[model samples]
Target: MSVYTQLTDDQFAAFCQSFGVSFARAIPITQGIKNSNWFIQTTDDTDGAPSYVFTLFEERPPADIEKMAVILNQLDGKLPVAAPLAVIESEAARTDNDKRYVIHYEDKAITLVPCLAGAHPEQTTQAMCHEIGAALALLHETLQALQPSEQYGVPLYPWSDVRDRESQFMPSDEAKLMRDIWHAYTQLPLATLPKGLCHLDMFADNTLWNLSLNNSQKGEARLTGLLDFTEVSAEHYVMDIAITINDFCTTWGDAEQGESVNFDRSKMAAFLQGYESKRPLGADEKRALPVMLAKAAVIFWLLRLNVIHYNRTEGRTGDNIMVKNPDLMKRLSAYHWSHVEKAQNTVFVLLNTHSNTDQNNQIVGVFSSITQAEQAREQLIRDQLTPDQLSNHSHFLIKEYTLDQLL
Candidate 1:
């Protein structure tokens, strides 16, 4: 919700006019960090006309923003994404003829999209996590058709910039943790990891959930919208999964100074189950998840620190902006790294074991916790057998094994 440039009513009206949209009013959306967004209300000329979200790209280049629009356009009908609208010259002008979706307003790329329904969940349920996981998998699968290039590929992190600053001010404990994690990260078989389009930031704030009419009775929430694809890029799909899990599965407890991070293994299991339902994670992906989680934590920590440092240097101390606490990420990184071995010990549900043939052993699911594995096994057994057949081969084995063991 950073408004770098302010627009008046007339300016907004003209901007809308250029796109052949009738604008009534624009209300500032004060939630995001990267772009300035406005919830625009329009006259109800059409009975079911959708509300619009106007965005001014603050940091990203116009060319990059254009590419993002193309990506969104590609995902328009397939996913529940707020794809950027095609700009119309006038009432008679055809939007199909024009490839340009963004317009230069005050030298910043500005575009409008139909605001998706539903609200961001404050506390995500296991079902919600499952929905998001499946959605992300679908997003990755859908975006595989695109060719990668420097402009449209993975965005480079300012690791050197952050490292230089960290050397000057980082505490000894935090420094050691970062070094250890970075060292381990470098040793990972990154070249062999599956690469695809990743939403890099699928935190709770960026996701929207809707409660159905029977939601109260069923106690379930449905994922309706996934917002903010500005950080979308081609990267390791597992890394993206780790990034998402770190946000959605981790819970925070209140403390005197800061909150304590606790990775909810059940939620993690549910998310992975949902993800695997769409696209099964490879053995390499499962093994690298802990390191990727730590890497994600470090990346965010560095990013937040850089943001704070730059803001202080630029003398924008009192500005209204969403500033994340780097210390939280710092603590989280240390925690994940320290518990890497434990976190990597996933539960494999062996549903059907062929006679002395290890390769023919049908594994039903991989879960983060033994409890989740047992539950899945129970459900599988229940589905397969009736009350009369329940006495025959209803037993399932839940084995705790590191990802490497499975490989």
Candidate 2:
């Protein structure tokens, strides 16, 4: 949505001609970070004719862009995705071959998607959260129809390149917190978790809503368009849920205001209930929710940092380029951890007997009996813990605790 690559009026007009449209104007959309987007207004002004969203993909290859287009087209009627419009196949355009949805422009991939109706909701309601949750679940289920591909939508998160540079860019405390949350995520039964294509970024701005201004239906908002599938990829269903909840359920506050992160319990309950109506979460997924929520916040915090780093080094600074506040995400990450620590189910504490610090202690599992805790500790050592950390049984200790004792 940001204007990284500025285009001239003549250039835009010619670009629109490929799609057999008389370009009236190309208004740069300054909202997103990954791509150059424009509101394409055609001169046709004909009845039933529609406007389009012209996108210049900053990173994705033409092939990947085409794949995204396929996904959008597949979900066109099923969901309110901004599906890419195929280019008119003139002899000149036919040279690209099979790349109808995406075209090459200065070695960059570009696409034309229908400008969907409805505006991005400024304040999300419980009903909006519920609809989005159901839509997301439906999206995951619908994408399962596609043949699973090893080389599908862009790679999964905590990308090694971004992760490796985190310590270099972020403060030691923030970096350590991010690392700790990620480590906790590694302890989960990820392989056994339900997997499907996920819109890894489902923030409020990414969704369009037909918000009722007047009292037509108790001022309810209905989700219309789901935008920006750049981060859509194969992911765990629970992780997707976590990502969506981190945005839809939480009330984001500006860091300058000194406001703490607030997650709406009622909204979260409504959202989850709506999702379960479509695809019920597994027992393991349910248990992993708290950690996954924290993990989701960590991912976005890292993502914002990466964006800021690239913008600084690459000289992508301007009003047109939107750089999200990484600090807000950082605060959200810390808040989710609080939720994780406060859970009543967090009964079994795994202590590193070799480590002297309180921070080394972790809540490993929730079990009624010491035998169950012992079994979990053994499994954790075998699977998650390093050999050096678990040289012998004396290195680890499991302590049962009540909620009050935890405080």
Clashing pairs in 1: 1-32
Q: Residue by residue across 1-407, what tens digits does model 2's lDDT show?
A: 78899889898888888877789878888887889988888887565344998999988778888778878877889999888877888676477547587779888898887788788876677777778889999998888887673356677655656877876776788888888888889999999998877888899999988866762268567788999988778888899898898889888766675655778755775677678779887779877887898898888887888888888889887789898777777888898776566554446666656555666655445664332355455555656667786547666677756655535
Summed over model 1, clashes come to 1
What residue runs in model 1 are displaced by over 4 Å at the alpha carbon? 45-50, 90-98, 149-151, 212-217, 253-258, 317-319, 341-407
Q: Which stretches of model 2 miss by more than 4 angstroms?
A: 46-50, 91-99, 215-217, 344-407
Best-fitting candidate, measured by lDDT? 2
CA-lDDT, candidates in order: 0.76, 0.78
How far residue 258's Cα lies from its native spot in candidate 2, in Å, is: 3.7
Clashes of each: 1, 0
